[model samples]
Target: MNTARLAADLVEELDEGGLRGSFLVRDLHTGREIGIDPDVLFPVASLIKVPLAAATAERIRLGELDGSAQLTVQPGRISTPGPTGLTRFRYPARIAVDDLLYLSMSISDGVAADALFGLTPPAEVNRLLRAWELHGITARHLLGALSDTPAERLPAEEGHLAHSLAISSGTSGRGHRIQQLDVARANTGSARAFVDLLQALWTTSKIDAVVQSRIRELMGTNLLRQRLAPDFTSDATTWFSKTGTLLNLRHEAGVVEHADGQAFAIAALTESRISAVHQPEAEVLMARVARVLRDHLRHG
Candidate 1:
């Protein structure tokens, strides 16, 4: 099967489902790639946590921060509307920097991500990416701001406001307030840039091998495997990925490596026109698209 042609057909299928998507697949060993609308930017949602994790690892390597150091999670210290891992706790708790990285990357924990952002700051994360020459990617706002409620209401541990915001955003029509928060000012990235980042992380000599291994391990343990993993993973294959999800956006970026040593970097980003609160088909379509790309490359 022709990968490029198949990718185009998949895009059309997604369009029929009221979705617009971008895809990129690169052979890590040969440096050859295929893409459809790969340069178009999409709201990355929680995918930004990948870069945040990289920055934190870099800081640990540089002795600027300690991964084992315990940080207290006070009330209102970090808010994301939805709490996961340590963020789900009521009273204050202490967590290590390394564990925080795990929660942020593996489970897309918003509070864990915001806490790391507090330590490294969004601007600093962007600066680190720029230094690495990844100019097309941006991590602009903290995860808490993505929620629809006011800042004071943000720290609600129950996640009621976040759930309500997600529903309203998905159901609203064009030009809705959620659109403003997402398209106008949300974290953004192109499929190609994300693939490039993954490639760098996989093959670059600049990042310490130990740190790189740790990051990959955390990503490999991601619990949300319904998006891209279901298609490509098997006994001889493993996927290391981070997923991003919001009202109408669903994305996953990662590297899939086979036991035979072939590895490919893949990024699939999508936006939907469906204005319903639930769209399970959107997730399934995204995975189908990914499976097509993976099989095309693996057996082509």
Candidate 2:
């Protein structure tokens, strides 16, 4: 099939599947690539943790912050709702900065991420990205801000309405009535931006070596594996990835390293027209589209 035709088909497939996404797959060694609007930006939900972990680890490496330092999170302090990690804990817990890093990346724990955010705010994270010459990703608010949205305050029966609001209340400029969904106010990134970051992380360039490696290990153990991991994981390949989700947005970014020394950096950031949460089919379709790009790049 011709490349342009394939992309056209993929775009139609995505539209029929109720999603529109920015996806890219690149061979890290050759720099060859395949993508579908990979430069389009989307509000990154928990994907902000990848950079947070990196910056926090870099600070630790620079002796500016102690990873072993403990922060006690009272039960009431877990203000955000999450399926795993410290958010689910019901008692006061003294957790180390290093462990908080693990929980934030591995389990998508908002409480742990905000605690780390308390140490290194969004501005400092952006500063580190600028210092490292990383561009296109903007970190603006704490993870708790995501939890305080209209979606969270809605009743169970009104969940789909929240999704509808998310889908419709956006401007042409990527601005939204919801602050967390607005690119200017939210943690946002493009597939190209994330793939660039992944390339740097994998190559250990533009970032401290120890911190880069630690972020990889954290992503390798990431617990939110239902998105891109299924398509990339195998005995001959290792998938290190992170997932991000808001009301109608879903995304994943990572590198898949094959045993034969071939590695590909992948970024799939998507938004859905469907007005419901728990869209398992959307997750599957997201992976399939990304896998097509990966296979196309890997074989070329």
Candidate 3:
């Protein structure tokens, strides 16, 4: 199979639809890889959690932090505006640090992710990446900070509707800028670099095997499957992935293992020109492209 040709064809098709995308697929067993614009930077959205998880695990391994320790979470402090997990809580709550890690990665929980980021700052996460020789990625800000509106940062007010409006307005402006592919101000990475990170996580003997296994386990339980997982996953084939979404950007990266012992690391990141808040077709397009690449790798 001419994997390169297939990738080019896929890119052409995506371009005709007014979408910009970057993809990379590497067969872990065979060292075969394919990509299209895989080195170009894209906004990573929640995908940044993978590195944060790695950093936290490393800290725990070094005995610098206790993953099992309880952390108190208040509604306004370290909270991001989102509907999932801890962000939905109306009041203060106590959660285990390790469990928070699970919530952040498995469910893409914004609040839980921000909480972990507080413990492992973005600078520390980037430093670990550099030490590991994964230089294609950057962790510059907490998840909450990425989408935070000025209104959200303001002191809590008595009127809920007024606060909601303010948040909505701020989010709209941020979304506009993000839709422009503002890489400088967003958490960014290239598909090829992300593949390198996944490879390191899977093949590196430098990190504790237990930590690697835990990261994979949490990723396998990820709730967002509309992008790459829906196309490559089956009862026999398993996908351990993390997804990132913000406005017009959609991305998923993970390792897909087949029942027959074949495994591949895939990163599919896309941006659509459509301004509609909900663009189901963009998600479907990503899934379809992934399926094309996976099939070609398996049988092409």
lDDT of 2 by residue, 19-66 (tens): 999998889999889899988989999889898999899999999999
Model 1, position 23: C-alpha lDDT score: 89
Looking at candidate 1, the ten consecutive residues that score lowest on lDDT are 171-180
**Relative to the unseen true structure, what is the C-alpha lDDT of residue 204 in candidate 2, on a scale of 0 to 100?**
56
Worst window of 10 by summed lDDT in candidate 3 = 172-181
Report model 3's TM-score to 2 decimal places: 0.86
Clashing pairs in 3: 1-300
Instruction: Give Cα-based local distance difference scores for all models.
Output: 0.78, 0.89, 0.78
**Alpha carbon lDDT of residue 255, candidate 3?**
94
lDDT of 3 by residue, 157-186 (tens): 433433334223334233333322356666
For residues 1-300, what per-residue lDDT tens digits would candidate 1 score against the true structure? 566578779878888987788988899999888777899877788889998999999899889999999888654333443345655556777889989898888878777888899899989999998887776788888876644443235454444454455435532322234542354566788999899888878997455676677778888889888788887789999889999877556899999999999999999998776654457788888878777776677677
> In terms of TM-score, which candidate is strongest?
2
Higher-ranked by TM-score: 2 or 3: 2
